[model samples]
Target: MDWYPNSDEQLLLRTSARFATGMAPAVSGARWFRDLERGDVQGELTGWPPGPTYQLRSAGDKAARRTGRALLVGIPLVANLIANLGGASGTPLGDVPGRGKPDEPENEVHDFPVMWAAPGSLARTVPWQLDPGRRPEDCVTDLVLTDRRLLFLATRKGSLAKADILGEFARDAVAEVRRMKFSEVNADVRVTFTDGSWVRLSVGNPDNAERLGQVLGGAVRMLAESELSEGQFDRVARFRADLPKTAHPPTYSRLRSGVTLVESRIPVKAGSGLFETHSILMDDSGQPAEPAPGDL
Candidate 1:
């Protein structure tokens, strides 16, 4: 088996990734997409004949499902909000994907597609394994970026599951990655491919979503423990010591303004793919600090 992030490959970011759906904003949720000319969006790919919520045969069923789950998942969503308070994730309940755009009446629909492509565009070739509806819940997927490539990796849920590369593209195949501020948790990102085809996806959390885009675009620097200054190393040690023993090994990155961002993921509820974050900002002397100009 080809081990991902081979020995020489440097990992930039690895985060939970999935299609940007419209359902969270409204009951008539649909998968979002657009054509190459950027002429119009195909955000509701799940719709029959592929149109809008009004076109759905059972938009009310979608509404009912939303209302039913509202009470059940509401608390978790709120906790999700508080946990990500300072981070990028979490938009209010009613905010739809294209709330502010009025000119493109199509854009006002309840959905927002992350794709930009032409008919038969390269984006149509994205692997189906990345779609949740097409896969088993027992299976999990992640979008991973390394110094050399951008790819998806899949595995069974839980720690023992062996991960296999689902698909990949040369790093050059990607033209740009935009961190979109709209949507739930602000976790959405638009990745435009070199062929002019693009996709919008939601990484599990907003902060990680922003970091993924920044690292891929070369806006910041990811660091290895050995690269840390002696003082920074000592500081990280203190930070790591305070985290739970189960926390994943911490990741370090240096922002443009010379501040180091250190973060780690720890188990949240103890099931497959459940983890929360622990982060700290280190200043010049390696003391805890607040966001600096570049850190923002």
Candidate 2:
């Protein structure tokens, strides 16, 4: 006979599945804020306080607007249906004529409950380094640290309330987290992932960078130390050292029970760098060896 879940058990299963998949639960009265910008906006335009204002909006409303836009744009409906679904001037539906702004000044920096997590899942917002030609101060967002992964929420351009999901780096996905000193006042945190992709975050102050280094580096070390055997760890370190000197350090991942994967970019004879990845098995001593065909 097969077992069936009761209503309560089914709900629990669903909630657990959502949490595991990174789906946020419905939040009531959750205020949304614009991503921090380097400089001030023009006069009284948004009614936000001067000097690093947290532009506020309703999270529920933003999600609703997103749903409506997807339906109107994605569904192939009749012209009349499309017009009915749209806002005045044939613009996207929802919100006032201007960008969606909250009715009251919700600028008080309330603790973002969504960004916070349980004991093992700690999250915080730190300034990140912008890409070339962008202002240094423009990058600030939440960095969520979980026992199994690291995640970040990035705000989209021109949209005050919307955020883009930046990363979901698992414990094994991260290769290294180190601090880089640009100058006496400028310091940055660099996160190298197992896939050879890396990101540099400008934490504004050097002290903040130090704190981030401690927190992030400590998490990585704890995970690696606990999961990898002594011999496997040594092989991972050696694999990192054997990579090309000019390229970024290769990322190491303990893929499964006994398989370890290394990802790197090496210069090819064709002049362009070739991305290379290797999967090896660890013996009883934890030394890396060529994996059997089925092991891969």
Give the TM-scores of the predictions, in the order they appear: 0.73, 0.26
The C-alpha stretches of model 2 lying farther than 4 A from their native spots are 1-142, 156-162, 195-197, 219-296
Q: Which stretches of candidate 1 lie over 4 Å from their true place?
A: 1-4, 23-27, 32-76, 79-114, 118-122, 241-246, 270-272
The candidate that achieves the highest TM-score relative to the unseen native structure: 1
**Model 2 pairs whose backbones collide:** 128-202, 129-201, 129-202
Worst 10 residues of 2 by lDDT: 12-21
Per-residue alpha-carbon lDDT of candidate 1 for residues 1-296, written as tens digits (9 for 90 to 100): 11346777766677778776544434134664556444454443333232332333266676686676566545434544444432222111122222122222343244455566776655666655666556677876778887788888876765554578877888888888877665455666778888777787877656666687788778888887778888888988887788777665777788887877777666555455545666777776787656655564
State the number of backbone clashes in model 2.
3
Q: Candidate 1, residue 66: CA error in Å? A: 8.7
Write candidate 2's Cα lDDT for 9-127 as tens digits. 21000000000000111222222222232122222223222322223336875577556655553221232132222111211122211112222122212221111111222122212
